[model samples]
Target chain A: MSAALRLHRADTQPPADLAGEFLARLDRRLHLPQPHRRQVLDELACHLDERVRDLMVTGVTEEQATRRAVEELGDPMVLARRFERAHVAPRRRRIMNMLMVGLASAAALTGAMTLRAPQVTIRSAVYPPPDAVQQVPQKPLDVQGLPPDVQWGDFFSLAASTSGKSPVVHWGALRELDSDNFGPGHSLGIDPLVDQKLTLDQFLELINTEKGFVADNRIEYREEEGRLVFATTHYFDRRETRLVTYDVSELLRARLGGDADNPDRVPGAVHEIADLIRALVESGMWDVNGGSASITTYGTKLFVRVPQRLLPRIEWVLEQAADAHIGAHQGASVDRRQGDPLHTPRDGAALPPAAGSSTVVSVQLQRVDPAAARQILNQAFDGVPSLKQCSVARWITVDASSRTVSVSATQRHAEFVGRLLTMLDRPGADVVASAESSMQVIPLARVSSETMDSLIRAIAGGSTLYGREFRLVANPQQNSVIVEGPTGVVTALQELIALLDTDWEEPAKVGAAIGR
Target chain B: MLHKDAQRDQAELVILSLLDAQGPLYGYAISKEVSGRSDGQLRLTPGVLYPLLKELESEGLISGSVEEVHSDRKEAAPDAAEGRKRKWYRLTARGRKRLAARIEAHRTWRRVIDLFIARDPMDHDQKEHGR
Candidate 1:
């Protein structure tokens, strides 16, 4: 007989009641098999032996000491239950919940297709962007002319089919002289600034030659936080003297102390701003196109060419100069400008205030602008409820501040809370069905892998999320696996909110209270 | 000759005795069917107050779990922790079934001697002890 069995041979087995409870708990916590549960107990026999030795020190017989040690430890069932309850706290539930919601929302908008790629180190592995090729595809193609359904690529929330003809590229828009005339048209170009020093006349003509680069046309300006935003439909043609024209708002914004509602009236100021930009580019005082600039006005009427790129070489040097005296920023005559509306119409008609308008909360799924970031939660969630309605926005923010990845949820009611009671039982990557009716936060484990895939795909296929570039990723991120892909600010922020919500979890009552 | 209450007074002792002599006792096998032999006076509750057994164990006395069960639920779980969960608790090599069984042994003797008195023992007590 084995030494272990032989040693246990003299001992009577535990009652089925005690044994059964111990086995069940081991399975749930360690994901061990029943036979495996026996091993755990077997391993504890050594602990039992040491405990018996301690009892023996008190002069008890060896057998009596061991028996006393095992007895004092209590039934294995009670111990198992105690360990399980202690190891898993409620906080982990919150993390998992947030991860699910954030991922779900991204999935909903991104065709719910999980993309997997090896973890590519940002510093070590670099690939030129997919569309970085200089040579363009077949041109003069009309994409909209084709049937609307011929879709390719995996951005489910948004779809695109460009006519090999004129490209309708518009990620950013600026300058609306007349909202009526300014439909949703966007024009951009990427001609590097200096070919050779030219008089003021040459610069104007260089910009005019490019498609839609003229003064009356609209051009995009950078946000307060400057991001390197590459635009489409813009091409560069290297020519004699290489003339390039870009919006000079960044450079001019600096000239005007940050805000230039208008920039045309101050004639002499315009000339000076233009001259300064010319000098900076010619002297190579700025990085090749890195002095970062935008088109702006000196004041209400003084048009000033400006650089908007963060950390421009030119701006740094200028600041260092003892006499950083450039031209004086002057107040020009005013020209009243039209302003955009407080709330743009959605669903074609302006959205009427529904009942419980005060309770109508909007959470941002994607950032429209800073002001929109603070929009009503209901309005924000109007189209993207898969994420925001559970309202983990605040919760998600809080968690990220405290921990790295956390397992959490935003359950609304108690019955819904039952969905999670079983999570302790599930092992491996699971898409647990969490909740069906947004009314109660009843969570269910994934009906199956296939079911989860279809659900995610169905939701994701319908959304028009932004910045979904195709790349490979690690396993939890692949088909039917949990994955995290690089997302644009709009999607990233939503995820951040989802992360924040899951930490300190709530029961289903939260949703019920609000829904009621 | 055995005293009338020899076995009844120390049931835990008798159980520990049975377990000590014969490796272990399942819940059903312990403390029963031997009742008639115990002068028809000894009775053990399987369903109620089983807690006494556990209380005895808390003091480092006796212990068990239903390990080594043959049921389908038991066979599937291959881990020993699981099997031990199925296996019942038995005495370690050092336990005397009664930690210091001498104490329980004396209590049994006292109870057995007491059984000698008549039911309305006022007559016997004055008669026996007064002598």
Candidate 2:
């Protein structure tokens, strides 16, 4: 017999009744398998024995040592309850094992189907009402009898047909312009010559020449931030640039997995943001001069050119977006006067006097302009709920002339003073903005080659992007797995692998948490 | 002062750090080391330590195996037979990396907090008065 069995059978001095009682209670409460249950009890017994020996060495009696040891281990019922919650019952595992095997392949096909189905239905819903659509005037051209140098007024028109007759090109209004008059319906007088077919590019060139605005329209297909991005830049003002970037990485990864029918199609959420931007522009909300924006899958960050007069509308829109639970951040300004130092806040004058004399704080932000300094103060105060409750705007004054922000409040508001000073000294935007794409190769220890291969198969079967976006290569030389992909996906995969390697880990929890 | 939840969260880090510093150790040794290192400020009961040990073992961060204690190798305990077996746990490569990451995060947090604490307003006010 083993030493553990011999000790149990010997039964000397009633075997510490406190420990025996605790073990009996734990054994009854525990839901672990028979082998695991025995192991746990033996470990607990060993721990108790060690504690008792240590305590007795310190001059404690046998009974006293046993009692103290049992007490230090804590209530057996609580430990048992925690262990029960942590253990995965064998029956539950059996059921999950069966379900995963059947659903693995089906999930891949269904996941792909669901991804491509709703996009078409959601496209129309993304557009604004009919009234919001800008209207362009339409005119037909007559080619039978016409003077060579005819005066075409506000609208450009040409008569053309695909049949073997002289194709007269008729130019219709491209799009309606609500405010800037930059959209369409501007005049383009052409020099009349022998009537021939004119290509679309030729017509666009003519319009570009006639209009002072440079028609810098460009479309690009590229990958950004782990998602495929199709960008179209329409330049209305040479001084301003607008980036209405949409993050559809998640939506794409979710929908276009496992033999998706149309993997190249754009996601619905991207289309929605594009449509919203167009509606906003038509509604005369594109009042800023030079601006750009990045609308991510979950967050929206915008940089708007706000004239002094249009600040109220921008504030109102921001408030509305906040109420809707939309993540929006106000980025750089597009004011031409401040264009010399791009991305930095505009400078301000000297500091103003405080309202109260109880406390006075004057902070100088070295390189930042007054307007930007004020914005930074507002955002910092807004970040902390307690400071935001009292409203930082009421007590603090920003001075552009001396480049100093003075805060005067009562003695009780000294906390605000401390927080504001810390903000001035905290890390700048440059430190916060640097994010590098990380690539790592983690060696799998004690995990069999077959298990790793099975994992690779499951992932590739579930997600269609396995070969393209995300690549998992097994390096036998290093006895490790090299996962190379976008930082987010690779990190997620690494976490999943760690979870899988855990012996007592709940496979269901790991499966459910992983997107694939 | 750490709350119960905060202490529980730091349990994994403490265990991994101990394993990295002292090599393989059993459950009781790990618990005792934690209490001793914290100068009795952080006391980990069996209820907390055992569950955390099991979790870390399951997470692939640490590997555990049973080691037999023979009379020839070390002093045999008086209570039981000559030979006894105890499970000992050692940190895997992943466990070491995890410990390093958590330590780095704690260091960064401490640095930020120190910056705020060091910039005492009263000191600034006194300096202005002196000027």
lDDT of 2 at A2: 32
Maximum-DockQ candidate? 2
DockQ of candidate model 1: 0.01
How much DockQ does model 2 earn?
Answer: 0.10
Candidate 2 vs. true structure, TM-score: 0.36
Worst 10 residues of 1 chain A by lDDT: A233-242
Per-residue accuracy of model 2 over A414-494 as CA lDDT, tens digit each: 323423343333334442343322334554433322245455444334332212355565543233455545555556556
Off by over 4 Å in 1: A1-35, A80-516, B1-131
Deviation from truth (RMSD, Å), model 2: 32.8
The lDDT per prediction is: 0.32, 0.46
